[model samples]
Target: MKWQNALKDYQLYLKIERGLSENSIENYSRDVKKLMVYLESHNIDEAPTTITTEIIQGFIYSISKSVNARSQSRIISGLRSFFSYLVFEDYMTSNPLELIESPKIGRKLPDTLSENEINDIINAIDLSKPEGERNRAILETLYGCGLRVSELINLKISDLFFNEGFIRVTGKGDKQRFVPIIDVTQKYINIYRNEIRNHLNIQAGFEDTLFLNRRGKQLTRAMIFTIIKQLAEKIGLKKNISPHTFRHSFATHLLENKADLRSIQLMLGHESITTTEIYVHLDKSHLTNVVEEFHPRRQSLKK
Candidate 1:
């Protein structure tokens, strides 16, 4: 089959069967498209099913020179999944990447901000501007609720449940969950909604969108990153940070305070407990405290 047709089918499968988000689907499709470009540029007339391991290896080798090991590993994984899907659908007899292995790479821990740093970043906001209250609310929601950038942008007015103290979040794969919201976060959101958002000339179809651009359209993910970057710069934060930094801080702080992994996992909407375990590594003291507080031999060890 042609590479284009195969890619189209793979995207459909990702959406309909796997229920992947549009961003994820785009990333997966891009991996396959890269291989197609490689083949076409080299004048190698190989179809999706006919492409050999040697050709695939050449494509990978070419990319490894430019990308870091982590990014290269992700591309390899994406290609493996694509071929595996083909095999599942009888498009191929076996997966070419079945024998290939990803490069050895250490687990990269996420960067987190301390409470002081977070407070400093929030305090740097210019409240004199019209978007000032809105910006403060955005940061608060991002850190307070442990939301992904996509989730924060897509949040709707109807999703707020202040009386119940929960804000419904639509996480990756379109899965929905209700996360608890603190009174402080609610107050900031109310200020934005009443003072800033309500006064904007909201365009059609964006009336329900909780966060908006100056044009009354929904905020983009890039805009969220820019806002955080500017705040970090204003506060002289030397560390590189993005919208996801707040999420990492939220998870890490919860672990340090002795919150259970499963609860944090659910709040972050992670599908696996293993993903949440990264926070345990962020603070080894938490593990030590767990053993000190709960272990049966702790009383004897005190002696």
Candidate 2:
């Protein structure tokens, strides 16, 4: 079997069997292609099933000059997944990357905004402006639903099942989940739709799109960032915030308010509970209170 055909089949497997998003599939394919190029340059030709660990190590060494440990780590993981799929399909008897060690990199926490800071930023919006209502709704939805900016921008009007207190979110890999929407957020979205969105002449193929620019086109990722940046600037906040700040704030606030970790994991669409553990850093007072009030070992013998 040709290497090219194997790569093609692998791409399909990632999309259909593994159920990765388009962006994720592209990244994995790029990583494998890089390996293929490296082997070609060294006058070594091998199909997917014939690849060796030494060649993989050589490829890592070649890229080490220009890539950082974190990025190299990601590429190594991608290649490992590709080869593992080959073994799963019986194309190979052993995994080439099984013994490969990924470089150690400490977990980097994402930037978060305090609830008060988020409120101050949203309060700074110029409500009299044409985009004010839209911005208000955008900010509310971002925090209320803990949505990724991509999911927020591509959000559809029909996807808002507000009457049922839920919105259908299309997350990574096109996985769909029902996220609860509070009445307050529902009110803001309704106001924006009736009072602001109702006036715009929406573009074709975007009539169902929840948010639109002045030109009636769908909002781009950059536009979403720009909106958040402007709000942060207006409030004189300096935390290097982004559209994702709202998401972080949502999770942080929920944890602070005593929400369950498992529920937060599901709401955030995280693949693992470990990913949701970062929010634990956002609040420790609850734990302190619990320990002070309920720990029997610490209770006084007189009591």
Candidate 3:
């Protein structure tokens, strides 16, 4: 098979067979495509079924000079998945990636906004323009639904279930879940949709998309990032923040307000509770209060 065709099939396998979301499939595809681009540019023709580990290793080594360790690591992971898919389909007898090692890296915690800071950031947006209303709604959904940037970009108008007070979110792996929506968030979204989005000449394929660009096409991921970045600048908050700050703030604020970790995990669409446990760390006051209230002898004495 041609390398391009093999890459496409591998992507489909990852999606349909492995049940990965579009965003994840894109990342995996991007990693594999880097190798394709490298091979093409160098006039080195090798089919996916015949490529060896040495070629991959050398390509990685050549690219390492220009890219950061984190990006390089992600590319390696993507390549490994591609080879594993080949093994799964019996096209390859063994996985060449089994012996390759990923660079070890420490987990970095993302920055989160305080509830007040989030409120202030929203207040900073000038809602006079048509895009302003949409921007406000975007921030609401990002914080309220705790959606990833990709999920936000692809969110469908049909996904809103306001009558049920829930929104159907398509998360990583194209996994769908019904997350409860706050009334305040729904109100802003409807305002933008009815007042602004209703008048726009929407594109054919993206008719059901929630957020849109001026051309009435679906908003790009970079545009969303740019929106958030500009809002951060206006508010004059100096911490390094991204669209993910809203998601982290959503989880952190919930945990601080005594929301259950399991519930937060379900809302965030985390497959493992361990991933959600990062937000479960209690503040000193809560820890002290728990100690004072739950101590058996102290409770008996107080009564």
Candidate 4:
């Protein structure tokens, strides 16, 4: 089969069968495309079904010089999934990547902002500008709710249940969860809606979108990054940060302040408790507190 045809079929499988979001489908497809590019540049004529482990290994070796181990591992994983799909469909007898192993790498901790730094970043916004209120609300919601950038951008006005103190979030794989919203965040959103968003000449189909560009269309992920970058620069923050940093900080701060992991996992819309456990590594003090507060040995000693 042609490489492009296989890729198109794989994309459909990811979307229809796996129920992956467009962003995830694009990432998986891009990995396959990279391998296709390498094959073309080297004049290596091979089809997906005919490609050998040796050729794939060579492709990995070639990319090793350009990308870090973590990235190479992800590409390997993506390709592995693609071939596994083919094998499942009876196009191949065995998966070529079955014997390959990912590179051993340390678990990189996420960057987090302290309450002071977060306050400073928010305070740096130029409230005199028309977009200032909107920007402030955007930052507040991001930090307050621990939202992913995609979730924040696609947030809908209809999703807000302020009286119920929860906002509905659509997370990875189109899964939905209700996350509690604080009164302060609600106030800021109300300001933005009443003062700014309500005035926009909203484009068709964007009327329910909570955040909008000046053009009254939904905000892009890049725009969210740019906003955070400028805020960090304005406040002279030395640590590199993006929209996800707020999410990390939210989870870390909650853990430090004695919030339960199960509660945090639900709020963050993490399908697995393991995914939420990364925040546990961010605060050594929380670990100490846990031992002191609940460890049977420690409790007996106190008694």
Every candidate's lDDT: 0.94, 0.88, 0.87, 0.95
lDDT of 3 by residue, 1-303 (tens): 788788889887877888987777888899888999998887888888787888887888889899988888888888888888888888888776778788777666668898889999899889888899999999999999898898899899999999999999988878888899999999999999999999999999989999999899999989988998898899898988889889999988887777777899999999999998777553445556666878998899997
What's the best-to-worst order under TM-score? 1, 4, 2, 3
Which stretch of 10 consecutive residues in model 1 shows the poorest summed lDDT? 47-56
lDDT tens digits, residue span 95-199, model 2: 888999988998777788877887898889898998999999999999999999889988999899987999999999888888999998999999899999989
Runs of candidate 4 with Cα error greater than 4 angstroms are none
lDDT of model 1 at residue 2?
85
Count of residue pairs whose backbone atoms collide, per candidate:
0, 0, 1, 0
Which order, best to worst by lDDT? 4, 1, 2, 3
Better of 1 and 4 by lDDT: 4
Model 1 agreement with the true structure over 1-303: per-residue lDDT tens digits: 988889999999999998999999999998998888888888999888877788888998989988988988999999999999989989889888887778889999999999999999999999999999999999999999999999999999999999999999999888999999999999999999999999999999999999999899999999999999999999899999999999999999999999999999999999999999999999999989998898989978887
Q: What is candidate 4's CA lDDT for residue 236?
A: 90
How far residue 189's Cα lies from its native spot in candidate 4, in Å, is 0.5
- Error (Å) of candidate 4 at residue 168 is 0.4
lDDT of 4 by residue, 1-303 (tens): 999899999999999999899999999999999999999999999999998899899999999999999999999999999999999989999999998888888888999999999999999999999899999999999999999999999999999999999999999989999999999999999999999999999999999999999999999999999999999999899999999999999999999999999999999999899999999989888989998999999999877
Residue 202 local lDDT, model 2: 91
Residue pairs of candidate 4 with colliding backbone atoms: none
TM per candidate comes to 0.98, 0.89, 0.82, 0.97
Q: What is the lDDT of residue 295 in candidate 3?
A: 91
